[model samples]
Target: MGSNRTNFRVIGLFLLLISMLLFAGGCNNKNNVLSAKQLTDNTPLTVKVLDVGQGDAILIRGGGQVILIDTGDVPDRDKLVSFLKSEKITTIDKLIITHPHADHLGGFAALVGQFAIKQIIDSGQITTTALFRQYLTAAQKKQIAFTVASEGDQFDLGSGILLRVLAPGKPLLTGTDSDLNNNSIVLRLTFGKFSMLFAGDAEQVEETQILKKYSREMKSTVLKVGHHGSRTSSSLPFLAAVAPEAAVISVGLNNDYHHPHPSILKRYEKQKTTVFRTDLHGTVTIAINGENYTIMREKGENAK
Candidate 1:
């Protein structure tokens, strides 16, 4: 009789363990992408468009969390690490890789060596470069929770800041000149009355599709000019839909590609949008407290 009672107790505990496992899984599947559980303290939302010349490396801080989107190029990895260290950022709550391009994913090696990245959100686009292979291997070695962002995926970055993936849905953009760049992950970060559109090198091809789908929802206070303001991006329709009060172009000062192309610059000028370039501004900082916001350049005149 004692033996039977012992068996019964074991069965009950097994059931309880299973129940806990199921509950935990359900919670994890809720968002499925990013993770930030801390509540807000009503502090200002700040995004530093780091001047990682010729590439993108944005530092988003808010809701008691530090998130990095894109990590410049191979040549700029050490610079990125130094800048983050200066800001006292050691643990990255989330690291977002817009796509697997050399200029975007090259800094992963440096980041992995320095920061304790809790989670990683990627575009899931494959590339056949040595750098790309190393990127995947490193992620596996780090054992970080990796997620492939899809359209309509919404992640709460605490403090009521909501980031919505707006592009790179199923059957990723193909048959393009540069499918990698065209299918780059496009994210719209919304917080209170301020919003910013981040299209990681998404050229006109992808822009057309996104504009058609999220046109009504694309209006933002700031637009991170696509493809570093190359002529291939910043389509007229896209610019009109976003209609941002300020636009930031992340590019090198004397890049061979001649980024922030004269033609694209004219478009921003025609729209009467205030332009901020990391090359000239040093590091562009955008601060938002509830409904009011300000754009302060690190060196150039602080903008509104």
Candidate 2:
């Protein structure tokens, strides 16, 4: 854990250099541009898409930071905390809440009592949910730094691991059917040649907005499928733009919403992109070493 904090300042400085380099070409946001002296290449990066039952709970470890994208639903909060303990994760450096939805932000309060949370980043979409208030209070009590995800804003998650925010910028959308869903935090995390795009329940509206703003920068190695594979997301154009070699869908078995729609599966197949579903595959894990990467599942064999 100490080594993880060692590169925080160096990475921050490197990120500033990257920002300045990208300033002239604002949209050319390269996910991985760390110099050899900066990256801890010997320490492989791993991303775990935990099986949280109908919700998103992604754990990204390596480069000295333990980052959690979204917690599972409230009912599964204990499972989440127990899993972290089992992994020996005593602290979470970054806990990013994609939106204010119950499923996405549910386990926040639980982790507050269980772990040392260093900082929190959320969509900042105001909602009158008790769970939301609970997380706010927890952050306040703990005095953890809180940030609202913004388009083009990037954070260095220690040791040259870059978390680039791609959507939910200023002038938030309004009068939408699900303003929350459309304004969810969309993040592109990068380490060396590996990159995973975490689209937090972002629907077609948000997808379209990202495509328009970051078409060239959207290509990634893996994509965390948006809206639990709802028909409202993964628009063909958007898919074409990102062109992730593999896609992971976090959905529960026999879920009420019937997520990871059959049509979306067909689209993934059409694009020759292998799809992994938490309901069918259990926990899906991706390990990255330099330019090589492998995806494994808890219930099934390893995927290419």
Candidate 3:
């Protein structure tokens, strides 16, 4: 009788352990399945240019799709992910790698693992970095849709918001010292009569090329200052061509680059352009409705 009781107790314990394991596995599976479903569900469109300091990460939402342009540096990945979660963005509809530079694409690998990415738009080819290689490998393994975006490529971002690619036009010049920055993807976003230009670190060389191609149509309401306001970028001729009413520069506070170069700021001042910067004021958001728009700083301070 004693032996039979002991055997029964052991069987009960084993059954309990198996039951607990099954329960835990089921929960994990359910959570993953739910997360996958969330990726496909449509969400309202909104654009947020996160303040990752000296790095760029623009979030565009519309038509139930969330598009992220650049992912900032590697150290800021957790902050970027948290910000997205706070905004209830469970998936990234499109991820645009404006360029291969570390500041632009460093956080990409971390993000790819955390979110469901539907498609990726890059300038075509990799520039050979550990991070870049990791991004490429993950992209391949996940079978994420990839495209080499260039001039004239247009896509909708829900509710009449349209993004048009406007740079890195044909031939894809390589082997030049300025190739990386010059090849940055420039995007023009149009919503009704309000439009903004996001030139991803495109310096004078690329700007001159862009002007030659789209001189008449470069005017915009908001300009995301290129190259972190580097003297090599945002040239006077380019500024005149863009003629943006307001400009935002994403740069780190007291950065080594000494961005928002004095000359560039003076030019903007001369043009009477309203300038806002991330290093000083934090995240800057511009919202457009028809032909009108409003600029809001994270700290609720008036942008200079």
TM-score of structure candidate 1: 0.84
| Candidate with better TM-score, 1 vs 3 | 1
Residue lDDT tens for model 1, 271-303: 888899998898887777756666777787622
Distance from true location, Cα of 250 in model 1, Å: 0.4
All models, RMSD in angstroms: 19.4, 14.5, 18.7
Task: Show where candidate 3 strays beyond 4 Å.
Answer: 1-45, 300-304
Clashes of each: 0, 1, 4
Cα lDDT for residue 122, model 3? Answer: 97
Ordering by TM-score? 1, 2, 3
> lDDT of each prediction vs. the true structure?
0.87, 0.87, 0.82
Candidate 3 lDDT by residue in tens digits, 9-49: 99999999999998888666511222223333242333567
lDDT of 2 by residue, 116-205 (tens): 999899898888989988888889999999988799899887676888999996888777779999999999989887888999999999
Candidate 2 overall Cα lDDT vs. reference?
A: 0.87
